[model samples]
Target chain A: MSGTVLTRTALGAVGVALGLYGAWLTLSRQTTAQIVSTVQYLVGGVVLNDVLIAAAALVVGVLVTRGLPAVVRAPVVVGAVVLGSTTLLAVPVLLSYGRKPDNLTLLDRDFVGGWWVFAGVVVACVAVAVVVRVRRGAGGSEPA
Target chain B: MTSTLPTQLPGPTPEHFTSRLRSPAVAARVGLWLGLSFGVCFLTGLLSHYAQNTSQPIPFPTSPSWGYRVTQGLHVITGTAAVPLLLVKLWTVYPRLFERPPSLRVRQLLVTGLERVSILALVASSIFMLVSGLTNTASWYVWHFGFRAAHYGVAWVAIGSLLVHIAVKLPVIREALLGDVDDTHSHDRATAVDQGVMSRRALLRTTWLASGTAVVLTAGATVPWLRTVSVFGIRSGDGPQGIPVNRTARAAGLGDDELGDSWRLTVTNGDQSVSLSRADLAGMTQRTETLPIACVEGWSANGDWTGVRMSDVLALVGADPESDVTVSSIQQNGPYYTVNTLQKNFTGDDRTLLALRLNGKELDPDHGYPCRLIAPNRPGVLQTKWLGSIEVQA
Candidate 1:
């Protein structure tokens, strides 16, 4: 066998072994409810990324690129991605805001307002890009 | 796009969704960023694992109060950045999932199967690590399992699968990255090159920007100055002494009476055990150091801690400075109620303290009221809040 193939196969075997060991450890140590939840979250994550996030990116990437002028597409799509991901990361905090019973110190921030401001900033940037693109004409000076 | 070429071999071409954006050129480029991000995260995570490990062959560092803070910070930051990069990388290579083998022979079938399985494992484990890590940083316990153990285990799986993925694709990566990113090559036949609204260069730049934005938005928990801009930042460093508390004494089931005047800190080695009252500890020489209490949950704060030096206390009890000291907590009934072992370096560090005060004021009840073990380059969890006693391990 070639060096690359041998190395790849060996590494692949190691990965599979380690993954199985991790799965076993998680299954063995955790309670049944915990195991169920772990599986649930694992599947949920895959679906979230592959189906929801990837599909959204694809649809938006296609839609904006097809509909909008060449100059504004990149910035608008990039800004939307940043805005969406930041919002996704902020969701848990926003939902559980001010809910810490023992210590209000944790998650005490006004995350809802913070997210709103973040969205406003992203929208403003996109609007600025749109204006610049329209003023500069269809293909004027690619987005920096 | 040419449908047939010398390298195409003798078989029907596999039909699938084709996009110029999903070229090998894009995959190799984005894969580099994704790989680097995961590498940094894994290495830093291992450092964190070693620092928190009970068994120490060589003592972890005791200087650089911000060592754990920076490393654990990078751990979360790199992982967060990978979220966007991973998405782009996967999107660029998603068509490969549906590509069929040219032949049904044993070698071809075996190769295709192995490659597909490895890809699946790599993607699955990466998603698991990123998602679970995000939840952990947010301190949202969506699962009942132990986060540390599962996270550690999955880290190995992710790294291993990543190595396999790299090894298998090194040649393609080398070829694609060797020339201009827009270089049309033999592999271009699989994709219809489209000079669309967004050029190839534009897409790459946007991907990089997205990743950078992700890091900047969430890194405030670690980078102090970015606290204002990091709107999605979990911790704003706004608490007692600009520190955040994970578990309070009341939550740990330790009432005010437990931490009242009767509380005593006991130090023991073999046959020699010394118990000192709160006033007794206060009468001893007090040293102050500004150290950040960095938690594994990813929030940290610098505090002016005043207390008796750990080395002094160990010396007073005639405990060997070269040995390990187990610091026990008053929260003796909970999961975190277990003992935290201090290695020789930590025991000998004069800066290590059984802290009684923070920022010139008594420690808040939530900040480990009576006394808390404070050491350099240690996770807040292992700092052993609500101190009870210290025993020199054999």
Candidate 2:
């Protein structure tokens, strides 16, 4: 009742949002095929990458719904927090990258479409995180 | 984690596998490709709006003979593939209508409601556009009610709808893309929870997985070597020119040199002082190019075009290379007019070859003949057949 936020759920949802935003920031600026290739290598496999993200996100969600952990959950959660947070800041730049091309004839909308998907994911995750953060505070930040 | 929430919601059963719900499946994934292909067409058209590349009195050539062909190819193939995709996607998403749809209370009402309405309109009109386009390409319409005008009109509807959909479904899209929202996936839910059973999370998860598969199939449909392993066997030989279409050439009332041996491409300047006949143009230098004519409407056919490049002819007449120009066709029955800039055309692109022949033969009257500028990679509207005169104006 303290807030419209998800209480413990806030910490967890925010974690997922951060991860999404991190991925978005990493991808939005890339024009050439290099980013896709890099992610393909970094994640090792596409399906594998999804699984990792899903597992991590779900674990964080569960952790947020539970009690707050400081020592273990803090550092990794902090890393994810940083990733998501950085994505938030990088969004405007990514947007401008797309918007600038709108007036120019040389740019393709496929690039814009690609950017939208990446950026949209980040923003969505942010919404979920904020909702949870306001409700319960940063209690269960760990899903490990 | 929640005391009130049940721990044993029934997981999505095997019945919910992709095949059981591929109707929308085909639409969404193929829609992405087809949609992007349309995007290419739309974008290329938009680019030409600023560049005025084709309208020039003289234009620089981009030199990749196949430059326009690739873009055109994507347009057609995406369109061809969409024929089946729209059918399937419509089927997949249709189930949403039967059940009492969920509420839109969570999101802002006006913005969200308008968006949802627009998306529905877009999806519907896109289907209309694609179907009408197919019919038009195949020449299936009976009464003929200004197909191009209607097509363009629907395009705005589709585009507008697309933007709204993007805005409204913004949340679900993120979670699907990010693969992280909540553990409310139908796969993960316990059997006891019934209230939240129709969770979007599960449908989206399925959609994403299915989307990946469809893209793979669509990509493989084009890849040559991959065709050897194609289990679905989706790819086709397309039309005679390796594009998609069924042209009844003989039925179209086309006859070889039907206009007779007296074929002349006359270039008349606005001043009317300088005019050149086909003979005069040929005397300077005649360039012949056998290039495939690709259109944004998603059809392609090859023909041999022989005549002086518009640039060369313009040069013979002392025309400026960089000025805007208009090429008009003698075929006045249809909307056979396009205005373009010189730089985009004759800039040594070699794409702007004037055609004198078709398939190692003389031009068929129905096809552009005597000489037509077979500018590659441009929409069907730009390739001016029966090219009459080149008028140079400021």
Candidate 3:
């Protein structure tokens, strides 16, 4: 076998083995409800990544790159990711998980307003980028 | 031109999405960020695990209360930063998932199968770790299994799979890094166009900027100075005495009405027992020390904790000041209530306090009302609050 293949196989085997053991330890100790919840969340994590997050990035990436001039494309994509990630992080806070009758100080922010303002900044930056790119005729050719 | 035409018999056809920008160079670049982020988080996570482990052969130190603060903060920061990097990394490599494996000798086929399985494991475990980790830091328990145990277990899986992945992709990563990023391979460039969109280099720059922005937006939970600007931070600078409260009195089912003047902190030394009320404990020489309560959730605040030292209290029961003592909470039951044990290092520290006051005011009910343990460099969860009793164990 090739060196790469040999190394891949050996390391892969050990990694997979250790991973399986950990999963077993975690699963065996959990109650049925916990196990089910664990499975659900694990699968949910995959779906959140492959389906929701990746799809959003690809779609928005394609849209900005395909529609905008080259100069604006990079800035807009960066803005989009900045907006997307910050929003994703801010969701739980926006949903107000920190707010409870028992605890007033946990979240204690106008997260909805904070997000809207943040979104506003991202959008404003993107808008300025589009204008600058258009004014400069930055694509160097007719945009495909 | 004829050679460029597709020439393979296909079964269960893979999805074909054409994009010239999704090249190995871009994937490797994003993978570098993903790997670094995960590496930092994993190492710091190990430190956090050791800090919380009650069975430490040597007791954890009770000084520089901000020690766990920095490590755990960096832990969450890098983990949070990885979210965007992971999404982008996966997106860059998504097309590879569809590429059919070339048929080969039986031995080669077996190796390929192992490689594919390892990749699958890596991807699945990484997703699980990032998602569950985020929820945990948010104090959201959407999963029923123990968060620490499961999170810790899956972390090993993620790190192990990461090693396998790096080993498998080392050559490709090396070549990608050595060559100019724009030097796309022939197959990838077949559909390439100079359409004036963002170049691969531009895309990488954007990914980096986005990650930096994410860190800036959320790191206020750790960097006290950044709290006002970090809109995404979980704990705003608004708790009593500017300290963030993880669990409240009401959340723990201990209300003002529940905690009456009749409450007493019972201390037992083998055959001997003593119960002291609030005034009795308060009247004792109140030593004041400033300590930070750093939680596993990645938020910490330093407060001037005023109360009696653990050693002085242990002295009351004629127990060795260096001995470990089990500290119990008044809350009926939960994972963190009655099982915490203060090690010799903690119990021996004159600064370690059964704090009766915070920032000079009488203890707020939410901040463990009557009393709470504030030790140096300990995870806040193990700093048992709502004092009930202490037992010196042999």
Mind giving the per-residue lDDT tens digits that candidate 1 earns over B207-251?
888788888877888789988888777788888766788887777
Q: DockQ: which candidate is best?
A: 3
Q: What is the lDDT for A121 in model 3?
A: 88
Model 3: lDDT equals: 0.78
The alpha-carbon deviation from the true structure for residue A140 of candidate 3, after best TM-score superposition, in angstroms, is: 5.4
lDDT of 2 by residue, B101-136 (tens): 234344445544554455455555555555454444
By lDDT, who's the top model here? 1
After superposition, the stretches of candidate 3 with alpha carbons farther than 4 Å from their true spots are A1-14, A65-71, A140-144, B1-15, B104-108, B186-196
* DockQ of candidate 1 against the true complex: 0.47
Off by over 4 Å in 2: A1-144, B1-63, B83-95, B98-116, B142-145, B180-258, B270-282, B301-304, B338-351, B357-367
lDDT (10s digit) by residue, model 3, range B271-390: 888899889889999989888888788777788999998888889989888888889898987565357878888888778899999998998888887988888888888888888999
C-alpha lDDT score of every prediction, in listed order? 0.79, 0.44, 0.78
Ten residues in sequence with the least summed lDDT for candidate 1 chain B: B1-10
- RMSD per model, one decimal: 3.9, 18.8, 3.6
Comparing 1 with 2 on DockQ, the higher-scoring candidate is: 1
**Native contact fraction, candidates in order:** 0.44, 0.00, 0.53
